[model samples]
Target chain A: MTVPSRILVVDDDADIRTLLGEYLRRHGFQAEGACDGASMRERLHRAEFDLVVLDLTLPLEDGLDVCRDLRTRSDVPVIMLTARGAPIDRSVGLEIGADDYVAKPFEPRELLARIRAVLRRTTGKASAVRPEATRHIRFAAWTFDPTARHIVNAAGVIVALSGSEFRLLRAFLEHPRQVLSRDRLLALTSGSDVDAFDRSIDLQVSRLRQKLRDDAKAPLLIKTIRSEGYMLACHVTEPA
Target chain B: MTVRVFVILVLGILFAIAGTLHATAIFHGPPFRPTLQLSVLGICTLSLAFITARMVTRPLRGLAGAATRLGRDIDAAPLPVTGPTEVKDASMAFNAMQRRIRANVSERTGMLAAITHDLQTPVTRLRLRVEKVEDDDLRARLIGDLASMSDMIRDGLEWARSIDVAEPFGRLDLDALLDSVCSDAQDAGHDVVLREESAAIVLGSVSALRRCFTNVIDNAVAYGGRADVSCVVDGARAIVRVRDSGPGLSDHQLGSVFDPFYRVEASRSRATGGTGLGLTITRNIVVRHGGTVSLRNRAEGGLEVTLDLPLAGAE
Candidate 1:
């Protein structure tokens, strides 16, 4: 029998910590709660946790400080929860080595999905730390800033992206020159629990293509494979 | 300023009286020439008084103009303190008052933002706790209520933040912004279409402008069923129009639609789900960018929202 993954949730709010702990436990994970940074440290010293869900607004020491300190000491995945959904805060969170970020007032299911995704990405690796922080990714005369979650064209025009389109594009940029099937694309962008409607992937791809200004009839950027899936027909370079 | 004007008026009246007395005494010796000399002296004194009065009231008129400008924009430049002593002192006081008002407004906005931000924690906690309810329908209803509460809190924060002018202005492609906004709305399954595009560029705060456009489009989709948006550059102004196909609003309703918390009772029911501050925030953002937004009922049974923004190089 497989042992459930252990998770530690750090939040100042007692009710939230307790409720989230219970929810995670109900979903078949060993969950623990910490009131603040000191307790969180003590818990980490006492037991091994697969992931840490850290709240950005703590009593004294914030989640950013805690995550930075944790990064120096350990490679466990940390997902930041912030009440402020500002773009600057998100970029700063990711820059400080957070695995993912979830704004407050988020759905519990969404949080669960994020936690699972982060765990899967970490456990699949030999060393649990994320490969260096994502920087500006360049592909096909376009500059994509993963931290800002937007793209700038060769003419310096910023093209705003929808959530699904961003995720799909990021997925493609991460693995270029490979045929990513519709099911894989769906699972990568919208979690595995979503109902796999094949047409949604095609529609999302077409929309992303339109945003990229890639000709749909004879697409030069993203190519469709017959009886398989789609592939990014371009080289992606990441600059620090 | 008032004291200086009063003194000028008194001095002018005294001079006019002295002139009259001197003219009467000198002309008393003559017969026909006496009447002519008296009348000329009277006209010259009247003209001199008129010139002095205008000079004295010029500072007062300037103060009034400055006050009117301050009323329209809280961050207007301070009144230039170049006048008589009393006028200078009055302008100094007016500038101080303007500073105090600006501080008070910023403080109020900060307080509202802090309060609204703090509400997120409890709302998130409540939402998570709601998940524990075993009954599906009860849990769903509870979640819905929580969602609307959070929505109101979010809107409240947005309204408070709409007055902020901290964002730096930059050249933005209007065509690209509208295209992205419309595409985003369409992606979310809303009935939004970008019928026309303009290559005009405007200097604006990017995120704030995006929010402004998004609020208008969202309102149209909510009340008017679908939004057909277009943009055109006419001379130095870029005009954007968003039209919808639903039943048009009444004349009275159209007038009050942009007012904060004003809703059309017949069509904009609670089920439509808005705090009614969408248009108010939009108008605030538009006015901040030196633009105007207006709503009018279309002849073909719909509502059209027009936004006019000055082109980047026009000013």
Candidate 2:
């Protein structure tokens, strides 16, 4: 009795667009495709989509540029499509606000799973509002607010997080001072980066730590527990 | 006389002797007859001097031809060292220049390829997250777009990496190579049949040739429904032809097929998921092996891709 999540596909390939559109529809989602960045912007302006699947290479403007521009406007979750064996450029893509990336020649099922996971996390509070009237959570001299989708440092400067990173940090904030393993973090974040064998969580954590100005050797907020995983050492306080 | 002066003196003596013999019958061997003989011999000696001068300049002409060929074909055989010492030294220098150019090109290609390969991982991660969208439509579209873009990147990167001379050259059985390519196509659910495979051996980089055949056969199957591979000896050259049953290319598109990023169909839609660099790489490989690759629109409503390699042991 609810509307299906909307997805925007940005690629220049017609067959891929048609096949993916039909395939996603069969699985119960509303999917539309744009051939390039200009068309993607037009579609974004026309409708409110749940997520964007962006390809890095395009005709007029590239997917990286699109991701950068979208980051300035919306907090919509972005998954990048990258070439097989292209590792160096991947870091630049991640730095530009993309939530995750997948290699080419991927299985359709894997793609479907990723889509479902991202939607579940980004739309976690759909329909049902958190009846708790408070909008912010305070943890160890830091303030995290899902409504604002940002974290305020001790100096009160808002540090921006990408859609999935925000979700990940929120998950950490939700259970402060507890060790959260990779699987738990993956489950909480629910994006394409949470593959069975992927080490993206560690990388994301490192990135998050860098932004938070937390020392890796002696992390104050999030500490690594050797082989066990990660623990948020900060105490969380939700505003009444 | 010493050797050099002896040769010149001998030439003068022979001319003088011939003059004396001609004068003996003309008059009784005195001043009038001797003077006439010397003048006649002088003309003959002058002609011989002119001929020797031209012979000495022949090496310079050969050097010029070699220089011209070197400019046209960077990989042409080294210039001959049979000329004078200075000319030989120049030839050696030219060969060294070619080696440096080849080395530079190879190094650049290697760096580009390495950089591209290193870029794949994070892009893949970003792609996976996009796939996790709850909206089924958005998720699928995003994946499709990403896949195509990835293909483009791969092709672009591969093309950039193709300038290297890493492909090892060796003797390959032309028939066996064609058979393997056909089998690969069959494995990929393509209808590729060898019309007449020659058992003739080719001295080439086996891996490069295999890749070339793979690209051509793949195109044949992807665009054309079937492939017909065959090999024949034309004169002293071994020619291999791959015919496809797909809609043949236009006359104009034939020449452009081997150019990088040149798709016959301008749009390059998903139906034909080509990055337009396959044929370019194929040509580069073939040429690296001292072979030539060409494409022609077959009159029988299909396209024919042909490769001409110099026959092994053929003069």
Instruction: Name the lDDT value of residue A14 in candidate 2.
Output: 66
Give lDDT tens digits, candidate 2, residues A1-240: 189888888877665666677677778889999998889889999999988988887778877888899878877777777665444446567666675566665656667777777565556655332211135678777777554334665754444454455667877875678899998897876644433333378986886786566898899989999898899997777666
Model 2 error, position B93 (Å): 7.6
Q: Give the lowest summed-lDDT range of ten residues in model 1 chain B.
A: B29-38
Q: Please give each candidate's TM-score.
A: 0.80, 0.49
TM-score of chain A of 2: 0.60
For model 1, the superposed segments whose C-alpha errors exceed 4 Å read A1-5, A42-50, A73-75, A85-87, A116-135, A147-149, A191-199, A217-220, A224-228, A233-238, B1-73, B77-80, B83-87, B267-270
Best lDDT goes to which candidate?
1
Alpha carbon lDDT of each predicted model: 0.81, 0.71
Error of 2 at B36 (Å): 8.6
lDDT of 1 by residue, B43-160 (tens): 6578667766776578789889989887667788988887768888998999999999999988987887788788899899999989889999999999889888877777777778
Q: Score the docking of each candidate (DockQ).
A: 0.32, 0.03
